[model samples]
Target: MCTKFYDSEFSFLISTTEIGNSQIIYEEFWFYTEFVNIFFQNTTLQEKEKERKIENVIKERKEIVIKERKEEKERTERKEKEGNGKERTERREKENLVLYKFLLEQLMNQRQKRNTPNNPRKNKIKRNENFAQKENEGSSSEEESNQFETQFQELVDSLMDSNSITRCEKYAELNHNISHYYLPIIGDFFDDTLLAVKNSLKKGSVEEQVLAIRCLLLFSITLEDAADEIFNQFEPLLLKYSLEGQNKLKIASIEALGILSYFITNTGDLDSSQKILRHCISILKNNFIPQNGGHEIYIAKVLNMCSLLLSLQANDFIGIELSGNNESDGGIFFEYIVNIGKSFLEYPDLDVRISSGRLITLAFNLKDRLEREEVVDSDIDVDAIVEIFNKLMKEYSQKVSKKTKTKQRAEFKQYISSIEECIYPKDLITIKSNKIHLEEWPKIIQLNIIRNFLGSGFQKHIEKNFLFSQLFGYRIKVESHRQKHYNKKSQRKEQKKNKKYRQQNITKERKKKNNFENQFM
Candidate 1:
């Protein structure tokens, strides 16, 4: 207590030294000294109380520190256990993946070896079995098949159970299970699987619908022997979704159909493939117009599907052409395709334009290959086709040049030229004059010359200059108008600064006048 009192009074004494009156400062210092002396008498009891409080606080702090240590230890132990559990789980997952991969690899190898034509034992051993033995083996084989089917059904049921299966896991399972070897087995249970897929499509969530579509796509690809029946089942579903579903579903269905077209071709059903192709083309024709809402993505997807169909049917197309089969003649179809693709080249969307360019380029490649090869009679007239292609290229170039700047116009032309060169490698098409480059010239001189020629009645001057301008390269550099813009900007900034300075000076003069008036008052 005496120490605290002395400290406070000493601080007060130092503060009082700043007092202007020496008498007041002296009186304050003396009074505080006397008060401190009187207070020193109770210092012994206060010191004991302070010591007791310090001991009590130290004891409480020790207890708190111990409790915190215990909690920290428990937390560390819990974290360690969790970390170990996670590590163990991760290790097990890695092991399972490795095992699954090894099993899959072994299964694939065995299937390949059994199917290989070079396997000598494959043909020799199966012919010598007795009737009884064959009967017994067939019975066992049927039993195994039953067992396999049961297992597959259970797997599918489990995958479809929303309570137990996540959407991502279902997709992963679909991708993992659908392969060259197991595809046929999966197709054996096609009726139930297709029903499940359709159910998912109709009633499942978005993710389930996508997975179901993927499943159907894989089923189409792998169901070789049953392609006709399965495709008959699938075609309606795909058509419904492509026509009436939401945007994402429509895109998926279109993509799946594109993939399915290749498998359809593989079935050697050219008529069916052609029908599918025609169906796709008809859809594009109906929906590609401006009044129908030309969704660019859907349009691109349709074009892509058409390209896939054409690629698959290139040989068939050649045969049709060579045999002069007008009944199935796709000439009108090709004309429609070319027209659609040419129109799309002018689409505002870059992706739409690119897809259109690819479609046209692919069509040209098919036509050129068909014409150049000796496999066909080469009787078809491609001159009109080539002329149309040239017209398309001209329009495409004009659209591109309009969208690009002067510096990039030449570069853009080169890009277009490269695409053309790739499409027609043997005979390249070169632009004679890009009209965009011709239009952006400073034509003051030409205008004045025309004016003078007209004024002086030089009748042939206009014709000569027009011919020269078309035949020669002449351009004028236009002056930059940016300097005037910079001058105006600087003039505005100077005016603002001058206005600010004038306002500040006026404020200062008003203050000086107020101060002078206050002094007088």
Candidate 2:
């Protein structure tokens, strides 16, 4: 039966088998079956191994992608850190540069202070030595001046910088301690400087306009050669600004116009100066309302303009020794200014009061000059002027309350003393050794005005400027050591010559006396 079952199951395989080979066929069939079974198992195992290999390959590829992504992230993170480090480095560099600049400026300032002498006597001696050196070394001094002018030209050109702060800084630098040195340079570059100033006046901000007006005033003061031209170019604009500009702009314009007019008068253009004075007076009369109180500062500024103009006119009139009726002369303006001053003597604002005081003082000075010259029959009431001053003084004294540190109080005291000096005039010797002496209040007033305008340049101008020398009746003759020694020797020789002449006269007188005595005997 087992043989039959095997034949039935393996019928296809045994189909070709013969009956004699049945046992062999059966054994062969068993071996074949075992071989087929082993082959199938091997095929299954190989397929499973192939699938496992595929899974392992997929896992390896996934790990590679993940590693690549991680590396890319790290690279990007490193790049960002490096970028941040560069930015920080750049910022630190800029800060360091700024700090370095500040330190350098401070060091330069310290060096300057160290070089400058502290004692006035030492300063004067140094100045004399410098003057002597300048006189002795002409070509070298000229070369130095040329170098200074080149530096000044660079500074003036910087006024046109696009950055307002830079322009302002340059302006301050130009107007610093040695501003007088820039006078000739400014005259040389007048047109360019005026153009820059005009541009600022036209389109710049309020602060810039104010500074530009100040520059205009500086030009008016420093450029005596271009006085008429400056007046012609700037007068209309200054008038317009005085009338139409904002508060600070108006004040600056008025001050600039006043200075310009003074220069015009100095140039002997009396008609133009009087016209400007009239215009300023009209503005003051038309615009100033004491009851309103909002325009007190404007009124004060206008008064200042009037004071400058009237003071200049009075000074010129007195200087020329003109004889005229007080009412028919420029004295009419003088009286007008006095009246305006009296009206504002009690103004609440100190500037207004001070300006009023200046006006009155100018009037008093004019009156005194007219009387001293015996030029005009005085119509101004002296007692009334004194009484008015007394009242103002009392009022100011009442305003003060033992405050030793108040600027206003101190200014008030100084103003009072100045007014007192004007009323009872005294000679004010400005510089040591009588370099500048003011015997008239008008000249003193003009000097004060100029000093305020020129600031640190005042002394330099006083010493070196011919205009100031003529105006103040002083001569600036900077002699070298050789010239001084020659002058001293000449003086000693003259003294010896006078002594010999006196001795000869004494011997001759003695001989004459003996001859007279013999005649009497």
Question: Model 2: runs farther than 4 Å from truth?
Answer: 1-150, 177-183, 290-297, 315-334, 371-382, 396-423, 427-434, 478-521
In the range 163-266, model 1's lDDT, one tens digit per residue, is: 42454455546544553122344544667777777677777766677777777765654444344556677777787888876677887777776656555655
Per-model TM-score versus the true fold: 0.46, 0.56
> Which 10-residue window of candidate 1 scores lowest in summed lDDT?
436-445
**Tens digit of per-residue lDDT, candidate 2, span 145-223:** 5555566677678889999876875665555523444243355577788888877778778788888777766665554
Candidate 1 stretches greater than 4 Å from native: 1-153, 164-168, 179-183, 286-297, 315-330, 348-351, 369-521
Best-performing candidate as measured by lDDT:
2
Cα shift from native, residue 160, model 2 (Å): 2.8
